[model samples]
Target: MSVYNQPRRRVIQMIMIGMILLIVARLFVLQVVEKKYAKLADANAVSRKVVYPSRGIIFDRKGKSILGNDAMYDLVVIPANAKNIDTAYLCQILNIDKEEYKKRMLTAILKNGRVRQSVFAPLLPPEVFGRLQESMYLFQPGFELVQRQIRSYPYAAAASILGYIGEISPQLLDNEAYKAYQMGDYLGLTGLEKTYENVLMGQRGIQYLVKDNLNRPQGPYENGEFDSAAVAGKNLRLSLDIELQVLGENLMKNKIGSIVAIDPTTGGILAMVSSPTFDPNLLTGSYRSANFSRLYQDTTKPLFNRALQARYPPGSTFKPMIALVALDEGVITPSYGYPCGGAYYGCSRPIRCTHSGGGHAANLRLALANSCNSYFSHVYRLSVDAQKFGGIKIGGMQKWADYMHAFGFGHRIGVDVPGENGGLIPDSAFYNRRYKGSWNSCTSVFLGIGQGEVLLTPLQMANAMCIVANKGYYYIPHFVRSIDNDDTDLLAKYKEKHVVAHISDSAYQTVINGMTDVIERGTGRKAAIEGVRVGGKTGTAENKAIINGVLTAQKDHSMFVAFAPADNPKIAIAVVVENAGFGATYAAPIASLMMEKYLKDSIPAKRNPVVKFLLEANTIPPAMQQKSKLDSLNRKAAATLKNGAGGRTFR
Candidate 1:
């Protein structure tokens, strides 16, 4: 009995000792091991401030700074620290009423819970900042002026391409993609700024400052032991030539359309212009919000990126690709001829040809040079109904569509730019759904001449020209040439070569020769430059839109696609001019001017008249302007149109 009692006593003693050790461990964790509550307790006396690093600079291929940082200030506030401050004087300095001051204070409190700091007024002008800085000490620790950097554009061009930055939205704050960002931070809203945001937005730094009872900053906390330095963002280099971009934008002034130019060798975009572009500076600094609202409400849609988003029928500009597909499929040879009297009579509704001379399409090259509608329509039918794959429904049309897909049609070409539209390229399945599988090649004959079901973006058309210029291979079109200090494989795809149609080089040579003839002696003669050999195609795309609740035919959209220095092509370009009749009249000259500028660095003095005329032409329909509800919209447009040229013959 004595031994059992001894063992029980030892066990009870051990249990008591274990309880004491647990209590000591808990105390150690609370007072020493964990620092969170300690930090919270010291929060009243210590202020942890965030330092935002300057964003990366953007340079053109020639190393000129297109986007750079401008010095600015942000007014920050801590609600709990606000005490004995001169609200009235502060309001006067900020140029805000008392009510607005209270509202802003309440907003800052709501954003940061009265303890942490939040933006009271962001992107303040230098004059306003100077005034605020003079009386800052009167406000104690409640309000502080923090240095900031805002985007500045010296050229004030490429508004759509450069995009803008704005305050982060609550919705974005909740997204995992923006988990690192706070409410007051600014983020890219569109264009290249949005695409390279992660690389451009550098890491934030933290610094701790000791505070007094009155919330005034005393000195660095613990000699800045917990401070962290910010890392600067990596710079970026773009393939865009700002001068070329300015030239394209100037040429597109008072017009409604887009121009996309690419380096055929590297697939780097040389110049991209969406007409009606606003100055990029309008979307920067303190006036961004108001100017943005004005630009957004403008009926001309100055914010719309037509080069990447607008879809149009390829028109006769698509003839070379059709010729490639036919040549690849053995449905037509380079010497294939058609004598349909300048019109395709195979279809129930005859498709007219720009070449009206009898027996004009004596060969495939001759047909392409003359843009004979009858020749292409016959070739399209032959490819879709060839015996190689059963018939249109069984395999022929699908095979044809396969060729289209290989050529980067019916899918986005994956340009580095955002908001690209994969233009439509119809297949057998599409026809099966639209026509209940009752359609034949002749049923969709308009597609043969690029007028029906087949639509393409200006980027896609330019890429197609690259494929032709390179004799079947193309690189993905991209804007940035390289990113400074970046080692990631994010841009690997752009360097890859895509072989489309798998057509022989000889077949491409035939098509290219015909295009050269178009600029030399055919409809696209206006596109020919002085010393440069240019291969080009002119397209007069039929435009139809509903006006006054009735579908009516409007003026044709002028279009042209070209490659220059025909022997060793460098630049491939596509231009579209809305509501402008005849591709040869407007689009061809625009392309020619751009080529001349790119190749020769400036338009020849002899072609100065052509440049002046193009620089001053307005083709927007009068009905469209009258339909705009914007007050004085038509009047403003008319005032600008006064500096432009009048129309000549449609063709």
Candidate 2:
């Protein structure tokens, strides 16, 4: 019985030892090595909550808070844990009907599943939050309140520039760029907010809580070791001057236009006012959707950003640029003369001059000051027909287009904002495409006077003024001066200087002198300010719009461009008042007042009447106002916003 029995005993012993080891290993894995099973078992009782970090604070140049945060609460729910809660009572606290409650619940479930937390009701007002806070315990683990920050404007201004934040859309959620963002996250929709979203949206944090059988939160899961802390976004310091912006907006009231003022030294935008603008607060808080729809549908298009996007003929305000180009091209010298006895008879179709006298067209300086339509028309014809570049085909039109591009025309200026429209500057190819090279400089002679196919945004016009002020170069215009704690290469582009034109300083001086005379002795005389030698040009851009399938002549758009202290220019501004009769009537005075307000900080006592007139002037034609509901809607919204903010009455 000996050997066989011993082997069998040994086999049995080894098998028993292996079984014992397996049992010990399994127990160790369940208790320590593999935590997955334990976590799964604890899944029903655990809630992972998102802690949204406060968005970055936006401050004006003077450190005044333009956009700030107000504390709010978002009622989030983990549907899996929402069992015994009183649905009726929860809806009452949330101020929603039963059907709405069901809709939100269904949305939450479909969004991230029943176990994950989803926003039930977001951005509760302080009063609503207070009411809900008192009865929060009744909602238990299924519904918990998470702190959030909604935007608030101290000065309800610059709605277009500041932009607004909104909940992430489904398309954005699926976008690769927004992969890091969750569905309930808020992102900037437009303006500077949209441009600097990455810098403004801080890192989100997460916290885990444990719930009991009744879905009531017991305490923190894993004693809060796994929780992450939220980091507040970086603060942005803008280049905007609060007072200047407010004043510009005020002056633009009851008008349809834009005011773009830039600091020529740095290309920083001091104030950009798109008339018919609404309160920025309208796009914040709970009323954002309704108000946004109203704004989008309004006939006047207050939501449209005119300064950066609206393209219009530069009118006589473009004469200086043409003069500069002509002087630089040697097509016309500073002393070149063109005889114009009220009308330029050189062209087949004689062009009429606004100035009746022929003496003013004797030289470029006098011609520019007078804005002699005949002189500029002659200059344009000569430049395009010059012997060097073959007439309007071989290289003439192309060269002219090149000059325009050098002045920051016909392309994006790379502004640090979203939705910048590059105004059109046509080349020979464009004309050839349309006319098969049949077009001569005479056919497109309107280019000389800033009419025809020429178009420019108020931003481009303002930048052109900056270029003229800076002599030959400019910084790419930007809203934010700098970003706090920024190490990334975000603002590198704005810091670089761009040399658009290389004309000599003397040529610029001659142009400047002409512009100065314009303010002192010519049409822009209304723009002259005492003690400050301002150089400006007044423009009455002809307005023609197609109505009922017929081209109708409308009121001319009033425009003016100016730079102060002529020698060491500080601010360069462009103002456009649509449907106004003449440039001097509305645009020039507004520009003058703005310059005075910025440089002198107050309008002189003598000019108080002018201020009163401008403030009270209703440039918007009554017929247009009657046809379009935009002005009324804007007024009502402004009144509501002013009253709500506890500010002074709508300016």
Candidate 3:
């Protein structure tokens, strides 16, 4: 009995010793091993703060302010640190409801941990911020009034091109690329802003600041050694001429369509105007909530970038390219001739020639001058028919399409701006999908005349004219000419010549001759400039629309393409007006005005006696109304011709 009791006593003593060792180990962890964690917990009880940097600025080509920053204040609160503060008094001072304050506090707690750090609420007005600052001491320890910068667009114009920045969404914040950005940081949403975000959004910096128990910053920590300086964003000098852009926008007021102007030598976009444009300032700040909703709901879609986004049939403006292909393929010489009687090739689908009294017989030059469909149809068929060429034809519809591709159609031009769509250039794949491999060469005849499945943007159309003006190659169109405060190497990528095709210099000469005739005697005479040789083409594309599930003919789309100083071409332009009768009537006049402004710095007065007479004749007798209409149409047609195509008469 004594031995068993002694063993039990030893067991009890060993258990007590093990318990004492476990307590010692716990005390060691709490006092020594976990000292850093304990220190952090104690520091959090005293103060915590965050610093936000100012956003960058945006400048135009001239270094004039396009977008800049404005000072504002943000309302911030810390749920864990806000204690024993009168809720009613705080709400009154901050100009917020009690419920809103409560909700904000709950949201902050959820977003941030239960730490004493300040959390940002939505942006507040300057007045509200002022009120909060006035009574800031009355609030809890962690409440703060943080000054911040807001985006402001100075010009308010070029909304489509400059685009706007907006707050980052939750999903965007989750993206790896956006990990560094805070939830409320602004991001480029469209246009140049989106395209050059990296260059525009400068590097973010950080610094350490000592704070008091109230969480207010108490100057820099460690003599500012820990601070990192922010790098300002670089500025862009776009090629766009601000004065011309303003002028173009004003001229197109109350109209629907677009106008694009390019410097043929540099591919610099001089002016791009889309009617129904909105002020970009509407999208940049505290006012964005109300203004953006209004802009989004507007029926006209003023936000759309019509110059680069809208696609339309090349119409007769495409004839120049077709003529080039025909001549280059040896399908037809400049001397080729055909009869035009308001139709082409006697096909059942007769094309109505703009010429009066049905149509007249035409040669290649005359055909382009008069815009005769028959001669073009003959060349179009001859250029593409292998069987007609005795199986030796290398210039067919596919070859014509390839030439169009070389002209920068049916593909993206790789402009620096974002949201550029590769306008459709139907290939065998597209045709197979549409017709299931049953389509043939005859099915694509309309493409010869720049219709059916062939689409082009105003920029593409202007580029085509520039290509022709340059006599062959063209630089890829770009907006930024140079970057401000950047080294020359910054533009190395853009300085290289982007040759789309290398047609022989002789081929360009033949096409230029026809284009010259079109301006001197053909369909673009109205686009002529005094003391300056100008070449151009006019197009009147038939409109088809679905009405009650039935396709019907509607108003025509007027279009014109022109280049100034034809002998030494400087500027090339394209203008399109939706539902605007004839190309030579409305479109040609506008193109002529833009060229006059660009070349001579002023519009030339209306000096054509025929046009002046027609203007005055409109006030004449009622019996002359029919004659007046015909005279007006003929004068416009003659102007188009005198600008190049119809001066030589082949009797």
Candidate 4:
């Protein structure tokens, strides 16, 4: 009887212990794991706000800040706490009607839950900020003015390169990559900003504020304990020459064109300019939203970065590449010559040569110097229809396309900047698709002169020059030279040497000699510098576009590509002037001026007259110029922007 009673007592003891353990576990979950009560308590005595760090500054090669931050304020609200507030006065300061105010408030509530903050009015004008700061107490814990930063361009150049920032979009917020972002957070929307967003965005910090019974914050809660400091974004150093960028922009003004300059040694972009560019300062602070729409819809299309976006036939500037391919394939030697009587008679439709005289195509260098269309057209036929590869049927067209691909055509170069267009590079497969597999080499002979179906962006053309300048290897073109305290591997790819085609050194040297001759005694005479040896090519690319549903030849686009100090090449450039007639006229002179300016650091007094003429040269068509609205917009908004947007100055 005693043993049985002891076993029953042990069972009773185990039951009691189990009940106590369950009670303790439930208490731990309620006190530590859950936050409902903690939030309720926090609402009563403390307020939490985000402290955004200053965005990264972008500096040119000369250590001048091209893009920097400016102090601004955002009026934010917590929907659940914004009760019995002066909505009417708030709308008045925001310069919005009551209906618009209601729409924003509802949007804020729906985007963020009732507890978190959403931007009520962002990047406020200085006058509005001052008024809101004075009346902030009336809104109590519901609303507050939080300090933030907006981007400013000190040089007011490179608008397309530096890009702009805007509130995180609805689509981005839903992605896993952007999970840390809230509804009102700002991020880079385009260009370099969008490319290096992670490095430039910085880490956001949270600060807890102590508040009184009336829900007014007195000061920091607990002397800043439990607060995290905001880490400012790392500064970015770029290879851009600020002065060169400005000069390029000025040179292309009132004209539809683009210019891209590169450092051949490293593939760092020196200056990239698209004509009709506006001040980058226009896309910052309070007026950003309004100004963006106008700039986007402007008649001249200033927002488009034609240097990296627009597609154009390389024209005669492409002849060098063609010659290289021919020489690389053993189809032609440096001394190979062609007989020309103005036009190439090999194709069914004769292709006319700019140089119709005899002996102009006597040799490779002479033919290149003369830019003989008949010579290059023959070379293209020989390369693609070579009997060694069983002609175009077996591997000829594909081999040519492969060489083009190795030279960075028909694909994204994976530049640091986003939105690079991979211009078309036709292959046998492409022609098969287009011509249903019945095309012949002569049928596409126009490609030999960089016309017909061939198209290329200015960046790609500029990169092609770098290949010739570097003798066979190239680095990926990029803006970022270095980042302050950078811990990531973002720039590793740009630093790697990308070697292409095993063509002999002799071939490259021969071509370089011909291109150098172009500046010395050929069509690119305008590209010659006083003391420096420059190699260049001039292109009068025929322009054809659909006009009223018909593909019409409107006018020729002027193009020039050059590399300076050919013996020790440092800078390479490509310039494209739309509808500006012959390449030797506008494009060659522009490239020549830039080369001179960079090599000497200033155009000598002798060239000042040439500069003046180009600066005043109005190349824009009369009808298109009449339709442009930028002149009126600049006149009206320039003064207003300087005074209204955060009251900060742009230099």
lDDT of each: 0.84, 0.86, 0.70, 0.87
CA displacement after TM-score superposition, residue 637 of candidate 2 (Å) = 5.8
Q: Summing lDDT over every window of 10 consecutive residues in candidate 4, give the lowest-scoring window.
A: 642-651
Give each model a TM-score: 0.89, 0.90, 0.80, 0.93
- Candidate with the greatest TM-score versus the true structure: 4
Query: Rank order by TM-score, top first?
Result: 4, 2, 1, 3
Question: Which 10-residue window of candidate 3 scores lowest in summed lDDT?
Answer: 642-651
| Residue lDDT tens for model 3, 1-651 | 688699899999999999999999998998788664465455443333334445555555456666676666666666776888777977776677988888888877776555634345545655666777766766757576655555655444577787877767668877998887774456777888888776777766665566666545567665555466767666777877676676676566545578889888988887888865765555654556656665665555567778899888978898888888777777777777776655554455666655544334346667777777666666766666756434212334456667779989988887777777678777656767888767665567677677778889988999999888988878888788876577657556666676656576677777777777888887788877778888888898877879799999877888899898888988899998777767887678777777787777765455455334323322122442333232332243335334532211111
Candidate 2, lDDT over the whole model: 0.86
Q: Please provide, for model 2 over 1-651, each residue's C-alpha lDDT reduced to its tens digit, 9 standing for 90 to 100.
A: 788699899999999999999999999999799875687466777777788898999999989998888776778888998888789987887778999988999999998789877888877766778988877767886888888777877677898899988888778888999999876778898998898999999999988888776555678888886689999999999999988999899999889999999999998999999988887877777667877887888767888999989999999999999888888888878899888888877768777766775588788778878888888887887887777997777888889899999999999998887889999998888898989868888778988888989999999999999999988899898889989999888888888888865688888988999999998888899999989999999898989999999999998999999999899999999999999978899999999988989898887799989989988988877765666665555565567666664221222
lDDT per residue for candidate 1 within 1-651, as digits (tens), equals: 688699899999999999999999988997899865576576777877778888998888799999888767889888898888899998888889989988998988776689877889887766788988777778877888777767867666777888888888778988998999986787788988899899888999988888777556778887876788888788989999999998998899788999999999999999999987776766677767766677778778878899998899989998998888889889888888988675678978777665666656889877877888888888888988988899778898899889888877889888766898998999998999999868888887788889988989998899999989999899999988899999999789989988774589999999999999998888899998987889999999988889799989888999999999898998999999999999998999999988888888887788889888898787876765555443343233334324321100001
* Model 4 lDDT per residue over 1-651, tens place: 688799899999999999999999887886788754465476558877789998999999989988778888889888888989888888888889989988988998888878888988887767888998887888867888888889866666898899989999789988999998887889999999998898899999989887777667789876787688999998999999999999998999888999999998998999999888878777887777777788888888888889888999999999999999999999999999999997899977777765666898888998889899889988998999999988986899889889889988888887788778999888888889889988899878988999978899999999999999889989999999999998888899999999986977788889899999999999999888998999999999999989899989988999999998998988999999999999999999899888887888998888888788778887887887788886665544456455654223222
Cand. 1 TM to true fold: 0.89
On TM-score, the stronger of 2 and 4 is: 4
